[model samples]
Target: MLGLSADNHHPLMLQRVTLGLVSLVAAFLTVTTFFRVELLHHLLWSNGPENNSSCPYGHFRLVGMKDCLSWLSCEMMQSEVTVMKLIGQGAVKQVFLAHWKGNKVALSRLAVSEFSNDFFHGLEMLKGLQSVYVVKLLGYCEDHTILTEYHRFGSLTNINSILEQEDHRSFNTWEVRFRLAIEYAMFLHFLHNSPLGPRVMCDSNDLGKTLSQYLLTADLHVVANDLDALPLVNRSAGLLVKCGARQLQGDFVSPEQLWPFGDDLPFSDDLMPPYDEKTDIWKIPDVTDFLLGQVEGSDVLRLHLFQLHRDCKRNLPQQRPSALRVVQTYKAVYTLLTQESELSGTYSGTSRDL
Candidate 1:
């Protein structure tokens, strides 16, 4: 009778154990679901201040202007901003990693007195062209000092090195890389159709130079960084612009950017024909190629972009597609590729089940 009781209790105990395990799993799943829902809600609704302007947090839209941060007086900047270390130096300014009110910021000071014109021009552009496509201008002081949001990853030039790190390896996928390419195209589109007028990326004379002109945000998106060389041209008024007085070479630059005059004739800025913003279009492929590094699906993306890029490289600037067109094409290709990948994954899973 005792042995029989023991066997009967064994089954009940086992059943209780199974029930306990199931209850624990259910509780864990419920908590996980709740947190995920909360996170989604926060991401959707808490992006910025409760205002109708739809601007990011700490930014407000001014009448007839893009979103902007509050202007920092020279006295306020000098008192509040603490310079940390020199991060970058260019012809016009020296950039420093700085701290402001417990936030990391980039502080730029005029480096060369001769380039004051360029520095002021960039500061004005930063103020006027404040948008989602460009880096956020936190504050500025007219004394040749400006402050902006600091991107820890630095410039797009450091993209490869960042991806190579173990902590960032998960971002090495083609989807992430393609998104970066899309952002770059969108930035170009924004510049070409800016509120100030059709602007050209005068600093982008080569691949390295082009990459250096943009910054890689901590979230892995690209934004226009160096606006010191942006110039406006009105096509309707028959106005054309040259990147610089100096002659440019290399296949990376558009054919029109090269010296059309023979070597016997000295390179003269007066003789060099000015080109439109399509010169920027010519460099799209090289920049996009660099953004879409050698990850899975990158080769396929390159193949898909080959024809469009070929059009971008056409000798005639007018023949190339507009920046908006390139942006649309990139987005479409990304959607198609992502859908195919998902379908492929589903099909493989179904095959395994069968």
Candidate 2:
């Protein structure tokens, strides 16, 4: 055997050690790459915007994959949708004035317990809607908080309070009240004629009893703030439209709308008569009444409105006017109100000017 020189042996040993280190590092990277890819795939499957492909209008398509991940990840919610203030609270949800992506928004932060499949289903139902009179839902967080377009002027209830106070004057004119009535009628008409079908039931609590449910924008336009709370009728199944666990209440609720199911029974069953679009007709009169109480108009206008109210209040469901017909009648009434306003020089400028 030949004896190797010491210098030559050192070089050989160093080469072997370097090769071993490189091989170990390569194997470790391979394992980590496999897990990273798997984690990304799992996240895409569970929370990506691509899951909303069935959304008819492509509401989620505009958001990129990075933004979609941001929408889904709970870690980023605090950074993205920042709550500015608490605006209002309902029986089921709390409304917050929030800033999302540099735009002012309303965040409806629901109880974590209430963030079940029902809230998600409600989001699915509302995703397809595109209308001026309806509040636009921006996105949702994992914690059951929904972001919507914030109305600058607050709600119709706020307007009512301002009207009641003689000092706070902005929307107190008869023309503004008349215009509000007409616009509210048009809002209902739009909902009743939705592509999702006319069986959609606006929340009973929001419609008649509390004016706060209708939000007033800076433009003086009225938007239905509780659209997410609406109960969508199964258009395919012709099922009874339900307002979730909360039932219709007050003097405006129709007799057919009542059925005690107790706690155990499911509400989608046949125990109650199928609630039709006409259910909304019963509530439209409430808007007219609220408007009339706020303004002193001509006897002719009041009488015509009284007749319209009676028509809407008919006991028989079939006897009530359709939302479309109500819209037409209100338009005619609006024209008369406009002419009177012009004559009396009480025409507060168009909603834009106001």
List lDDT for all candidates, in order.
0.80, 0.62
Taking all chains together, the TM-score of candidate 1 against the true structure is: 0.80
- lDDT score, residue 93, model 2? 70
lDDT score of model 2? 0.62
lDDT by residue for model 1 over 231-342, one digit each (tens)? 8899789899998899898999999999987799999999999988999999999998998889877898899999999999999998999998897777667656655777
lDDT string, candidate 2, 1-354, tens digits: 898899999999999999999999999866755554434323212321133333334343223324321222445556677888888776557888887666677787664455466556555555655455566656666667676667777778666665666553555666566667766777678777777766455556444444666777654556666655555556568665655544554576665565556558765544655666677787777766666564556345678777777888887878999887887776666555565666899767543245
Listed per model in order, the count of residue pairs whose N, CA or C atoms clash below 3 Å is 0, 0
Give the Cα RMSD of candidate 2.
26.1
Question: If scored against the real structure, what TM-score would every candidate get?
Answer: 0.80, 0.68
Model 1: weakest 10-residue lDDT segment is 345-354
Q: Which candidate number would show the highest lDDT if scored against the true structure?
A: 1
| Model 2: residues with Cα > 4 Å off, grouped in runs | 1-78, 112-115, 164-170, 205-210, 233-237, 244-249, 259-270, 298-300, 344-352
Candidate 2 lDDT for residue 50: 30
